[model samples]
Target: MNAPNIRPDIRFVWLNVHGGTFHKLIRLHERLRDSGLSCEVLFSVGPPRGLKLGVDVPLERVPELAARGVHFLGRTEVLNRAEKSPARLTVTDAHHDPDLPRLVRGLRARGHITAQMATLLGDFCHHGAEHLLMQHPLTLFFEMDYNHTPEGRGFAQAKTIQFTGNIFFEPTANRLVNDYPDREAFCARYGFDPARPLCLWLPNSCDARSETYGQVIEAVRGAGANLVVKLHPWEYAFKKHGGEHPWGLAATTDVLWSVQAVDETDGTWAYRFCDVAMVRGSATILELPFLEKPCVMLPLKEHVALFRAQANLVRTCCAALSDMRDLPPLLKNGPPAYSPQDYEAGRKSVRIDTTRDAYEQTMDALRQILSAPEELPVFGSLAPLRRMADPFVDASLIRTLTPSRRLRYLAARALRGICG
Candidate 1:
């Protein structure tokens, strides 16, 4: 097949992820191509992506970036006017910024399409109205929780479609099926006594107390279970959060496998491997009922509310009528302050019937807001949002410094977005 002719006109944006999101973006791109829409892809770059060269620390993609014309930009980085920003291929400048509109317009005149992935949901929603409105089809794609959108006017135009790519449940799902060290091997791997039950703790990065990992470990010990701890990747162990329990207690060698590396979804695989799971910051609370595995969630966290909400959804939506009866409540209230012996009870999640009806419903809802004879209200508002002091290019500030690295990072991220 011929490579989609690179044009200044058509531009598409893709969000990069380790798994499902990547494939889905490719699928979307393919769909656009098959429809004969002239288009180009603007790949949303992440942090320092290791390429063959020195490294692409960060760069933003542009209509004109290189001999190959693949532009690179930092992901949501804040440009400090304090220092002179880098050049166009690697940095933002008056020439590129002011000239960008002409460049994009040039690409459009050349008959190319432009699309983008909104990486940060909060910032995208709160700040990205103009950018979204600039494009024809602004899709918010993820298996995100239903509440990610604020129930107000701004959301009416953007077409939000959710696909989990199993990231949300992949960790838990992998744990359920992975070939693990037999009881003895797992014990040896993590240095727990084979005779004792292992209580595994995996916390999301932001909130320590909310994840309640400390309390879970204590509870497991209180319940007489051995411990294996996998911390949230974002938590800088050396940086003390109020002198909380020092992580010196968890011997790195004794850690079996951390969800940070092992499971990007909901940390379910990590939880499934352990006899008991203590968690904070992940949405895996809903997975336990279906897996029939036991899990503990930290209170005073948002998940505390999530669990309650899930429980209510299940109890009211599917109880008695379907197998997914108990899950809603388990997700809501959390397991009793104790262990559940069997899944024979009515509460549990059934298979995730990803069928035509569901897809239709999703599309219908999206089209209600996103469909357009001209421009969709939801997406047309995000262009100005991207032009902020920081666009989607240097979002996290990881690649904002060091011109060479930033450019490379942006290029690789853009390149990774091949339409499947």
Candidate 2:
């Protein structure tokens, strides 16, 4: 269905073109309405370019948001007629889109404020960082904390950065207070044994091998623990077969009997019930530390070096397993004892800002930008650098690279490093 007409007085437009982006944007929208903001806030959904790929709002979630009283807009409608439907500010998650720089330029020329919100922890080392660098000179860049600030990373666009705490924190905390189930209730809902230790497995989207999943299952069973496998959204949307298990797990009967697989977009509620978490170098692991849940790193061979380089703090603060066989022993032994001081230090490493509420800080930053949008200056030189480096990080191109093309990718990356 087509989005309804966008009112002229809308002050905030949130453009979401991916499920993950919508997840964050929706929570922020709810908070904005609850804060009693007088201005109009519209949630705009963009068309997905590929099949089950770039969809902004998942079909199932449309009614959910509508029930919450969020006004809707098709992004094309707003952008195509930018002058007629002017919003004081537009917000999007920090993601790579080839057309983003052009869109930002067009919107700014038409007197609209553009901002990107940080959705992931440790975004500097994630793909979003490369994307953020491409969209420099934004009216505002709402960073999660000090670790994500542009100046801390020596980026040229420091002036555009604002240190807001983790966007997921406040929403998740509220849910825990009001909606979370007790341990017994949670176990009963999922058919987990209340006595056995519960292990939550959050795997990366790229490595969904049946053999690896089988190994994890065996290790969990051997350790006498119950397993809950939370599939990443990509895995659920694209990787699953027409069966109860995702494509990789259909053949394993253990998945049917022993594992509980979940595909929900928001799985934070499960964190409180699980005793431990096992991950394959996903950013989701960063959230576990804040909850005081210990994690076991099960990095794949291809990602070991990258994981160590970017997530060393996670490896140090939590348990790291070099071999799958070691998982059984680690689970059986229970999570390593971490003092409050240890958890506090881990929180600092991820740059969690505790001084104010994240949603409030985000609203304050938006107000500041709307009041004085021209104060944020653009660095002309960095634009060319972004253009030059973008292709090296393009997700589609990287996925289809041949051996010869990979050499070129490496060469381009080296050149970008030297040039920067």
Candidate 3:
């Protein structure tokens, strides 16, 4: 329960729709609530008509949150202009949400601070929305660590950007070190054979590039390993929008596929139990070294060029296989042996500094920001242009324009192709 007789003067609003990130947001909310701040979780399904990109519905946790004295705001009520209030602070784990700019502008219009607590750790260049959002004056971009948040890298110089440390990963690392669950017990709970070696297949949103997940699972099972599959929230988002259908696990093997069991929501339970892990292009591949676990990555044909260009550090960390035929041999030999140099490169790339406590530093930052006297945020270079464009291109109208969706997607694809 919340501390008795304490009222929150500062409010932290969590507006994340991704199931994976929602887990971290919940932990962050608890940390702040314990610190005596008023916390409200604003949950949503994701951008309408755009890529849904998230696997979980955050609004479902309302009753659970109410039981603990934390307030939960549904998406409709939160988005309704009639009932909206300028929160003292609004925070999110995702920048991909199309409505985020509107929400941020609304909060800042009334002199509130808006922050983006990034969910994944990687080169920020891979995420275009972050570049656009961080350029805004009222925004504060929180990085995984000091190295990730360098100065004058196209972000607003006047706004506050800090290496608040990795709130999600650091706590997860601490838990894995001090309070690890029993591997056998976890296996039993998930109905996996405790005796067999388990491999975790964590695929990102675009897993349908070369081969379907069913084909991948068949190859993994042929390697004499039990597999645990956790689809990225982005994949779920795509599925919800009537995208490609995911594979059924029963035909491949009695693979464990429970959302609660595999998703590191409560803590890093899945990684603790698995002997080896695999990914295509996930930041989680970068994090495995911190846990001292070996990871294997198989890049699809379509994404191979992009990965080669953007994911050099990730390649250094994991053993890259050409195809499914090569997986069994690698699995038989156990996780790859990384040199000291490889470990350093992976740590440096993701900025996983276990020396500092991210939760403490983040909470401290929040406290300081809230206690400081309020001032209206200074506008960035694009504020005038954004103000003029806001009325014309609001989210409500964009959602209703089904005729233009194809053109928008095509234009975006063409732009990306040209930029690349």
Candidate 4:
């Protein structure tokens, strides 16, 4: 069934593309609903597939998500570029959401984009629309990080509220931060161990970013490490014998097809196993030190302020990188403020109330935005998506796994003769 219409009095929640970032939004939605407020969500079917993209309906499970009285809107279907767009292999456009212009215009008129979606939302507070941002700490990422905040306003369009990293990405607690390998373990796992240091290259798999692949690939091949190009798991799927669509790579620098992926390509895990992790982001960079690895970053220029605003714990943890190459000239600018002392405190630390606190923060910000007569957010709200959500891992393999009854995680520790 089509999602219900947005109530006239409801606040409009604008989000960019939807994928892993939804982790926090999902949590907040449930909380907001219980409190009796409603919101609207905007997304495209598969990561902005439009010549210009608009909104998309999520999978059954996503809509079924208990977003606290939230209603999804702007659902439209476009070509699945991963398969349908033959022209997609070369030059492509991430601006397919043709409705985006309309969406932006509508949001601005509604007054939500002024604060929550667009950092500009702050400029529109008098209109009464509220934006809820689902932020992650991918220091270099665009869709879901600080680039949408006050600092990035000079360049990045303000359509979403800015939140911190951990909230968007949930990291595994330390299993003893192991050495991020630079050898063939990543290669051997995927069958390409020609024996160069393993250099893991993670790309922004969005179609909007296809134009930069050449630049990225050049950096990957030029870097002295073995090139293990791990495509974001969001858009593409790896295939072996014509199976396993939407999968990615191992630590090795080969594009070998696979029937299964460990969901392990996540930079947090790769940071522990790879020699030098190449990212266009701070998400992995922020978490790299726990594994004691260095990073090669792509300079996007929008993450600086967020770095300053992040909790000191996030800053302290990342300064340990072996080297910070990639944008040498830009080094004069410096990274966000993350203190090393705060690292130990945030790492492997779990706050059961973190989720609800984040939710209340977001809602409170929305309310503040509604009540404010000013344009910019006079005060930053809680970093809703920065806290890691609850996760269940398979004890036997130590791989992060979703909760389940069939695989039996609840009692498996006992089954293995280990006490929980």
- Report lDDT (CA) for all predictions: 0.33, 0.53, 0.50, 0.36
Candidate 4 local distance difference test against the native: 0.36
Q: lDDT tens string, model 1, 1-420?
A: 012233322333322222212222233334444555432333333332201111121123222233232323332321211012211111111111222333333433443322222332222332212123211111121111122244223433333323211212222232212346466755564466777665565555434433244444445555555666655422222221223433333322113222222322213334555665544444444444444456554443343433444333223221211222332344334334332423323132211222322223322322332333334234444233222212223223322224564565455445444421
Question: Over 4 Å off in model 2, which ranges?
Answer: 1-24, 34-84, 98-102, 122-159, 169-180, 239-259, 373-375, 379-420
- Say which candidate scores most in lDDT: 2
| Lowest lDDT block of 10, candidate 3 | 129-138
| Candidate 4 segments whose C-alpha is farther than 4 A from its true place | 8-15, 47-63, 66-98, 107-114, 118-230, 233-283, 287-315, 319-360, 373-420
Which of candidates 1 and 4 is the stronger one according to lDDT? Answer: 4
| The best candidate in terms of TM-score | 2
Measured with C-alpha atoms, the lDDT of residue 212 in candidate 1 is 41
Which model, 1 or 3, shows the larger TM-score? 3
- Models 1 onward score TM values of 0.40, 0.68, 0.65, 0.41
Candidate 3 local distance difference test against the native:
0.50
Ranking by lDDT: 2, 3, 4, 1
RMSD of 2: 8.3
Q: What is the C-alpha RMSD of each candidate to the true structure, in Å?
A: 15.8, 8.3, 10.7, 18.4
Answer with 3 or 4, whichever has the higher TM-score: 3
lDDT value, candidate 1, whole model: 0.33
Instruction: Give the RMSD in angstroms, all C-alphas superposed, for model 4.
Output: 18.4
- After superposing candidate 1, which stretches have Cα over 4 Å from the reference? 1-153, 159-167, 171-187, 204-213, 236-268, 287-292, 298-307, 310-420
- lDDT (Cα, tens digit) per residue for candidate 2, span 257-347: 4566743433655677788888875767666666778777774676454455434544445777778778878888886777767766666
